[model samples]
Target: MNLPSLRATERFANQMILDACRGAKRVHIVDYGILYGDQWPSLIKALSERAEGPPLLKITGIDFPSLVNLEKTGNRLVDYAKSCGMHLEFHSIATAAWESAQPRYHLFSELLFVNCQLRMRHIREDGIIDSPRKLFLEKILSFKPVMFFQSVVHADIGSPFFIHRFDGAWRSFLARLESFEETMKLELIDQSQLDFMDKFIEKCAMGAIACDGQNRVERISSYKTWDRLARKGQFGQLPVSKRALEMVMSVWSGHENFTYGMDENWLLLGWKDVVLNALSVWEPIEKLPRFKHQ
Candidate 1:
């Protein structure tokens, strides 16, 4: 959640989305499923220096509060917004609250269901609950934000969790993209610009790659979840670090047969389109695009 550099690749896509809507007087940033506002300071810092007309930023971060971490990061952002002179607001809504407030406040979800981790729990209680899926899609189609950008987990479609539904394979998982595309039904704006897989490959090939003694890298990925990768060892293998390994352990810990291509393995799936938006494929980050004000 702590993107060391506010302008780096890991955080670039989300930043680009906000930057695209920079001219709006009241920018409603809806962070529903995942709430990590620690990223706000870096964003506010980056935005304050922009040459465009400064919009009176009205920020709203929505979330399933009980399920996620909101306090620390939210407090930090509230403070940052006040300091930057941006009009601020926060809406912490849960599913039950959403049901009651559906009369007025908009209820929306910009997610592909496989990512929700809600497929099973609902079915257990209702014995065959398809209503929420429709609700999920309905909210999205209805809200139709001015500038919409979201990451839907599309790997291993029909995951073991939904084996009966997705059939479970990388191809099956990616196939959902088409169904999702047909669902939300947005203005097809190809806004991709970062070659994450190629960059990872290049980073792995170059001396930029780093690894631990056992050749494993301890990675705390986007969800702040812990991952342990270790190389071949004397009887078995040993983790490089008890917690998180540094850069040295990352190089060799990467997938050896990692094929960085145009296919699904690519981290930033829409990099090609975004780069097309920038009108050129850049080395890492896409050069900023000029978004028209609404």
Candidate 2:
């Protein structure tokens, strides 16, 4: 997460989360793919540190059954939050597929936030009603979060055909960067950074020539498709102001090698089309359910 672009994305999301829980006693955040659980500490700190903010914060981190240590991670976070005088009800839920887990909506209350970062790529699985995209809409509409935050990688590669054919300008740009040895110098980059850059190049090259048309693992669609889905789900997009975009880009301001962009939907993506990370916050078109008032 040392990548400036990535750090910017996380910062953007953190602000959005804070805004959503501005003045509340309780907040529940459902993180679809809680990968490494790295983003929560900062968020927890923010909530606890806020002088006048939500009094209680509850996070329900959900992921596939493969994340064996999820509860252990959640407990650690819980302990950390408690030490800081914040009540963090951390729960780790393991399920086969989050889309199919829509029936689990009863687990969360109305003061909720849905954080779906880089997890949309797995939302489609070859069916009509059971499609990942359809289920994603259904999942959010179920609880109708006060705020919805989503960020995806290479969101423009919606289809294998599009992945096969890169824009003329983009292809040339990648070619130029790949040949530049400066990016791989140990003094300038770490093994992790080198690994990320190498794999990204390999994916683009392989995607261009690989004959298997239906094997795209991260089946992602463009932001346009996501916009359409959001509207269909009766959600309204909140603009990420110029100031926010500027903040997101601030990290890369002096870095000459990186390029940053904000799509029409105000989603942020970096490094041309290769490393796409768009972030958008949405509010429910209608009031969502809340726990019964005393």
Candidate 3:
């Protein structure tokens, strides 16, 4: 998909990953929902051109077993890495649930990075005592990655209440439609492309409004809710790096409607007033020692 917001978010994330892996000899990246592995080629190219040479890169792609062809994706990446003359290892973990793949992640001494882009919201948030969302976050935290990067759409459509969810989903659907319209006006979008965008937005709207319980796949939450969840899971937010900011701006130089800003530590990318996506970096907080009670 050539959506401006999606492209912008991916670019921003690639920059952050490149910056984070600056001096590492061996780097391991765990990518959630690594659909077609589109984000890595640029990072691979940059890493290969590094002054000290590219690190021994290992990427573990996790996704639903039925949704992706892991072997095909890995082969493509391996071929691309070979073309760049960079040594790379690709691992694939296919599972129905995110937390279930925890034991399968092959951790090594490499500096670790976890990338979750528009994927976490799909994990059900219904369980009061032990929600899947919380378990997934805890699993990521357990990895103790050097950097954890995530990008999510900022909306309140995840609410369980039908009325509230409908309101949020309606507004979100409109904002996305408006963005596409505005983008088409500024740039030349073909009829087919426009139709595809419409279908994508429609799917999301239907999922949010039509489906209920586990059936609702498009469960989006606000950035604030994500922040609370991350903190509760003992993760500390990191400020957006200046280099990442510059890279995003440079990519978006010509587009006036697409804007980027920082909300505390988050890097917010929006179309006009409606924030479409929010990207943030996080790290596991160290456990404090407890003195014996006297």
Choose the strongest candidate by TM-score. 3
Cα lDDT listed for each candidate: 0.31, 0.65, 0.81
Q: Which ten residues in a row have the lowest lDDT in candidate 3?
A: 285-294
Off by over 4 Å in 2: 102-110, 160-189, 196-215, 241-243, 272-275, 289-294
The TM-scores of all predictions, comma-separated, are: 0.44, 0.78, 0.92
Query: Across residues 166-246, which tens digit of lDDT does each residue of candidate 2 receive?
Result: 453255436434533343462377767777776775664454334233554445556667777788878888888565666
Where does candidate 2 have its weakest 10-residue lDDT segment? 175-184
Runs with alpha carbons beyond 4 Å of true place in candidate 3: 103-108, 184-187, 287-294
- Predicted structure 1, TM vs. truth: 0.44
Better of 2 and 3 by lDDT: 3
**Rank by lDDT, descending?**
3, 2, 1
- Candidate 3 lDDT for residue 147: 76
